[model samples]
Target: MTSTVVEQLIVPIRRSVTRVFNYSRNVKGLKTHLEELSDAKTRVLHSVDEARNRSEDIEDDVGKWLASVNVITEEATRVFGDEDKANKRCFMGLFPNVTTRYKVSTKIESIAEEAVKISVRGKFDRVSYRPSRRGIEDRSHKHYEAFESRGPVLDEILEALKDDDVDLVGVYGMPGVGKTTLVKKVAGQVKAGKIFDVVVLAVVSQTPNLRKIQGEIADGPGLKLDAETDSGRADFLYERLKREPKVLVILDDIWERLELDDVGIPSGSDHRGCKILMTSRDRNVLSRGMVTKKVFWLQVLPENEAWNLFKKMAGDVVKYPDLQLVAVEVAKRCAGLPILIVTVARALKDGDLSEWKDALERLKRFDKDEMDSQVYSALELSYDSLKGEEIRSAFLLCQQYRVVER
Candidate 1:
């Protein structure tokens, strides 16, 4: 009986001693596993960097996995720290500190298992995805009413755009002649036809903001400009534009000569894939100032189309026999300007026969010698038709800021 009891005690004591001996080895093994985890983290971080360069959004699971790796790494650092201190607690630095070593080794084993599991989970087929581009849905062809007159002009512009040799195309017309609307319509068509891989649009207006223009262009391609200066942003924008295989940059409402380089456009010989389409009131701004390769003059609608547009805006009252003659004369007074036609048509649409005659007389009375007198007179009539001073002031405010889209 005594021999059997001693044998059992010996067996238990030997197993305990063997486990104590493995504490240091277990800590070392933790180091190797943590290194594997670090390698995995590095690979994932590299992928994240690449995805960011492409302007792609990181995957949710991938992002979470990265966070988890960071936490595990920090925990491993603390474990290694504990292991160092635990080694110091040994007798004369030559024996293991059994209690602390056991505690640290057990914790290390648990954490190391977690790290391995997370590393394996980090193997993803894709780390990021292409986000939906904005401007297309919000701005393309909003409130565009196609007319027979606009069709040919749009076709001509599209044709010029498709030509590999034509890099700069210009569309010039008087104000309220639908330059903005025409270009927007072109934007819609170009996108649908795939004439260009992408279309970026920015309005230059009478006073141009180079920074705003650059920002608008960058927004189209999902490029984030971190540069603080205009020139720096220009450099970034120029590089970005160069990468597009085919891109159309629509610089609408350019009042004067705009420096393409300042706006970061890679026009002419700099980039063959890039094409610029601009609009302005004066043909000279486009021809002489911009040195456009091809210039298209957008004339006011022909008389027939003008009358059709007026009738559409003014409603069926324009077609009534009693009002038809006076309406035709009133439509003629608009001089075929689309903005004038729409304005006068709506103002008189709900009025009586007497009101129609009064509008016709007032439109006829504006000084013909003044530039855009006819347009001004039509706008005045529309202005007078408003019911309140507040609404009229708002109208003038829009006019002052040039925010009123033609």
Candidate 2:
């Protein structure tokens, strides 16, 4: 009975030793598999941004698994070493403690099983990427309506987009002159026309947020990025963008030149199908640093176009016979700037002929700086329409500093 009990106790130990060997072999094989996967070369997965992203994720997972396995391997080695010392002592007539031997074997078994599970989880058979045939959908297209006067400017931009040699196109104009609207229209047209595989539009205001910009660009191609640092994000963006067949990046309202490298945007010359369309109020921002090919200036609407836009916004209020002449004068005072015309017309949309006349007189009081006068007076009228003193005060405070570069 004593011998039988001893044999029974040793059975678990023997089984555990076998499991440890199997675990080691399986882990070694898994490490080899992971190394092969990490080293395998594949075609540029441009069309499917997800595939590239998935590939990176797999690599990261493998790296983490390898690290974990290293720990498990060390534990297994220590457990086996203890078993060897116990056996050697038994051979030297120092009868090894059966309980300690059983514990060491159990520990090795547990660790080996965990390593096997990790190996199984890290297995990847093959990778396939499908290219996207459809262009990116533009959701903000509805917010921007193409102005009649921006037709020529739109044409110029379209021509620039078509030019193979022109990788960077810059559009500049005075604030409230429709720079954002023109670019939005162009982006919509490009997406609808399938000019590029992916079109990303990001607004970089006076205060540029690099992460926000990268997030916007990543959203275009459904790229899931886990980069914590700016440079890491840029590198990830660069790798993903480099694989795309054609990409159009529209950066709107850039106050100053943004470094393309810093943003992870490869130079136009480096990538054939990559193009950048940036809009700014300052021509110097584009010419001096941003634009690479040609800079297109967007001018204010002509008199007829300005009047048409004003009438459209003013609606029936400006249609009254008594207000016709006064409305024309008010529209003319807008000086072809769409923002001023729209603001004044919308503000007076519910006003009577007397209100229209009063607005015209108010506008006439500020004819000192011509264009500046019209813009300020029109904006001032809009400010006056505010319901509260606090709101008016806030508007005045904002007007003290020009946040929007003109």
Candidate 3:
């Protein structure tokens, strides 16, 4: 009986141990599974973060693309529109329809408002882009003076030319104030292309050289003179220049009447029909040329314009975080001479505040009696290099006059 009892106790203990071992194995398996699931979730979170970063990158690329498209569109619009249209918002003025347009009316196509398309055949009166508003409204006069000027000066010249033999229309201004610029722009407007069929641009300077004048006239359309020789070149220029009907001749800078007929410049038409545009500094020179017509004088740039021009010429070196007052004071010293503005700008382009201050002090102490000593002479050296005699004299005369001739 005792042996049987011991056997039962042994059986119960072995079964209990087996059950405990099975339960422990199951618990370990469950813990391992939980750890694996946690690892998988961490990987998913990392992938989600990567996707968000890629999306942001894509958005930035798209924004850049949009900006590029906008720039291209603006450029395209500007290119397609007509620039010569009278109604276009040019900072300067327009030339009146003088003889006939040298080219097809480019400005006509650019008209945004209710405007008319004009040509030589279809009009009783000349075409013009008359101002809707008056007196320098939204116009940048200084910038126009520097690069190009097509304005009221041209309009009067063209009006004078309509008589068919008007000989001279002088556009006189100071050297840096844009007299030559205006005359050149006017020549572009009045010369013949499709409508008028003739355009003549004769650029001369202070002392007229017969050969240069002859060559200039001969180089235009419908004529090519052998300007290599003095006499033959003159004859060729004179004969052809006389033949063109309804012509606009620019004797750009005439210190004197220059005896246009004497130099191979043809003079067949009565003084009523032919038109000449001359620019010079001396009011007496211009008055002698245009005795009957009223004259227009170009002025110095306003204060703001002079400073802006100075800054542009100065370039990246003149930038100072704290020297704006110094800049304004220096700009004031320039008064309104575009040439001086450019000179100062080039001088100070690589300047600091110290350099700016130094320049201002120098100009302040400049000899008021001798403009030539301070500014005009420096500018005149640049003018002296011009091949055109008219340009040189005109530049000198401009230096002589501080105010415009009425």
List lDDT for all candidates, in order. 0.82, 0.71, 0.52
Output candidate 2 Cα RMSD: 11.8
Deviation of model 1 at 224, angstroms: 1.3
Q: Which candidate is the best by lDDT?
A: 1
| Candidate 1, position 140, lDDT | 52
Error of 2 at 328 (Å): 1.5
Q: Across residues 159-262, which tens digit of lDDT does each residue of candidate 3 receive?
A: 76564445556666666666765666555545422323455566677667887776666555535464567777766666665566655566766666577665
Best model number under TM-score: 1
Report the lDDT of model 3 for residue 11: 96
Instruction: Rank candidates by lDDT, best first.
Output: 1, 2, 3
Give the Cα-based TM-score of candidate 3 against the true structure. Answer: 0.50
True-vs-predicted CA distance for residue 361, candidate 2, Å: 3.0
| Each model's backbone clash number | 0, 0, 28
**Which residue ranges in model 3 land beyond 4 Å of their true spot?**
1-158, 161-165, 191-196, 227-232, 267-273, 289-294, 315-319, 367-406
Candidate 1 residue lDDT tens string, 292-405? 988998998899999989999999998789899999989988877887687667767887888888877877776888766655555455466653454355346425323322
Task: Give the winner by TM-score: 1 or 2.
Answer: 1
